[model samples]
Target: MSAGPSADDVPAPDPRLVADLRADLAAVGGDGYRVDAVTALLGLVADAALHREQPLAARRVVTAAVGAGDPLAALVGAFVLGLEVPSDVLATALPRCGLDGAGRLGLLEAVPGGRARARLELRPYAAVDAAGGADWWVASDLGETATGGPLRTDHVLGVGGASTTLARAVVREPVDRALDLGTGCGVQALHLRRHARSVVATDVSARALRVAALTLALDGGAGGDRPGEDGAAPGRGTVDLRRGSLLAPVAGEAFDLVVSNPPFVITPRTDGVPAYEYRDGGMVGDALVQHLVEDVGGVLAPGGTAQMLGNWEHRDGEPWTDRVGAWLDASGLDGWVVQRDLLDPAAYAETWVRDGGQREGAAFDALVGAWLDDLAGRRVDAVGLGLVVLRRPVDPSRPRLRRLEEVPGTGSGALGAHVADVLAAEEQLAGLDDAALARRHLVVAPDVTEERHARPGAADPEVVLLRQGGGFGRAVRVGTAVAGVVGACDGDLPLGVLVGAVAQLLGRPAEEVAAEVLPAARGLVADGLLRLA
Candidate 1:
């Protein structure tokens, strides 16, 4: 990967300092500095305000806590809140790693009046993966909130919305080998370690890899090939850091699982445009996303899975699915894409132009105009942003599952488990012939519910709906035939028997009713609305 002029001021990853910092943070981070504790201290209004980029309330709360000799308040103010703390107070906050270690790590900058300020963002991160809950301190380059200016063209992002979205969306099943492509600050790699026996984290920026190494080491996972188990994983492992762009670092090797939140943003290649490395892969338009969609299969072992978040253009005279479907047609893998949002050119331009801290002004308007011109040149109508799930089937003869649709509510539950179940069900359904499927017993998922809609005084329902209470929260309208077939699926009767009873009750041929309901049954099974008995 090309370095291409990024931030080089970050301190090199020092194993000793990282370990010392981890110990010191743990000493103070337990009850006082944890996510819950910090939330409690900040109160709901201030915490909510901080998320909205209004930090005045949080600053007030932390300022008072600091006066009360709260070490956590000192840590939060100096690092998270971007406030300068007295040197003595910071020293009290971190006794072991202390001020010297902080200086060596480039985490602190000396100010006048014996005060120190944070050069990096360090905060407690807590989340639940498929395995269980985790709490770890993450370090990354400070952002516009702290710097009070535009972001660097090659900023290494901390734990942000995009990172967490991909993290929660990733399939957390255990794997023998895994790869985290574009591992900025090693957030995804941190989760990968919990399930993968070996993890290869690669990045284009040497600075990013350096920070990633520090993050990995601080989590007590040693760098290199020696396998180690964390409390969160059944068989945790080592992280091997590599420097390269895209799939170059692991060219010949294939992994059982690969997760990437790549720099798939569509950006103009015009001279004046700042190509941020964290978002832009130095590629024009949406070609980076296209390249990843088509080429990621090369690194997947048989039956291996890959999950990615990407953006694709919806050109005029073309559907969004056709644009992404073409990529999957070229790839020899089963693909499922869920488009979460569709933004028009104007909205897209405004969102991205302001992403680099450009407020409404002449320069911001100019950049937005540039985005509009670049997009219009390609006849782009809108851009669809979504999650992409791909799997290289173990059996090459198996038919590919190429599904692209919009699911409203994702990231609301354990999506990893739901995806795993869906994949397994699809594979099982594939092996079952029509006759075999009829013989199989199925059960309605516990979260499944039925709703009926009709005219105010009508006896029969005009519309029947089957709704999923969890795992994507999908709702599908069904005919009475299909609805009856599903409602009787209590794992007590075979599917064919249920269809037969519904047909007999309606005075219709069993074959016709089965033909209508079977397809819907298969779909509901794959969507987690029904389960195999």
Candidate 2:
């Protein structure tokens, strides 16, 4: 595999050029470029090829992006098209920054005949979170699609699928302080500012931190301690960029929320197989993820929450839950873990090796073999990928809520509100006794629906399911008594009274029916299907 640019090659984007670039991006129209526009520009065949990590088809569109008068087209050619453009074309694209400023920003390198090629990938990014929609520019090392080769060890990542996943998963309620651990390119930090009063983004790689600082600067939320125009001190747009691994930089300091899309990829420790710092944590097996699970709560204030994306190894005899459960137990924090994907050894090996841009060649085969050997040595059968949301209990005397399950298709979209609601429910349920819970009136959530299925010739339904229309889309199988109880919950009567009425209709003891249905009711509330009125 051929190597791409090193971390040292990434130069600090000047704030002045950042301002000019921001203006240039705005002049081209909203958010610079959209996915649909690029797709239309590249056509179906070339777009599909580009999605498959091959840039040859995209390279064919070089003339289109460069020759067009739109600054969007010229900017696309210079960066996304991966083509050297004439100095005049670049100047036309970024009239304020110009080629000289681009070169100063280390985004482009001067070539022969006054032509310049992009040394890095810089583009506009747009997103809609709980706060609403906004756009910003981001710069990171060129990927395999841009370079058509392997990535450097410390490649600063751009906004990709994983970045967006964590961004949407983050709980977006206003808070006093927030921290973005292992904040590569500072994408999470940028999003955190939407809700957090102050955000501190930290990373182990100094180069990554520099790139992250540039990313925030380009986005208008420039990091540092500078005061605002009115002299009231910087607010939402200000971030404190720090350099450290895990939570060491902010040790003993407490935060209301924390988010991370860490280097949780499980890689083998074998010779000739390069461990990329962006993904690998330089630890054996899944130790890095385990360590985070065991320690992230130390910096969290009471009732604070942390969300992260990670991977765990599964041995032959033990279940995936057992592996992750142990880590949660060690942390002593209330946690809800959702395993999103699982991959066998072969599939896992191919995914990572190819992720490093190594095709199905001898090197790829060798790396796969090493990965398999490493797994075999540990008696591993498969790997589980998931999202974990943890919280430090406000009442230390209460037992921590521990929930571990697999949700392969939790569906897509922002889950910040759903997660926050679940945590809140857990706290509420933990505080309430059985008598107190039964006395409270409840209502079914707006997004919940009931479905009944029966045999073709049958008159009465045999199966009943309560499905959530949004927020994790959980479907709960309900028995006759529970189904009736849930159907009657409309914020009018207390749960105990409803249970008594149902028990009378079924000719059963109220105490016996209450014992059976109350647990399920609590579960429904915890998952956001039902709420206290």
Among residues 3 or more apart in sequence or in different chains, the pairs in candidate 2 whose N, CA or C atoms overlap within 3 Å are none
What's model 1's TM-score? 0.94
TM-scores of the models, in the order given: 0.94, 0.92
Instruction: Compute the lDDT for candidate 1.
Output: 0.83
Q: Show model 2 residue runs off by greater than 4 Å.
A: 1-5, 29-31, 34-58, 221-237
Q: Assess candidate 2 and give its lDDT.
A: 0.81
Top model by TM-score, which number? 1
Task: For model 1, state the Cα shift of residue 532 in Å.
Answer: 2.1
Candidate closest to the true structure, highest lDDT = 1
In candidate 2, how many Å is residue 487 off? 1.6
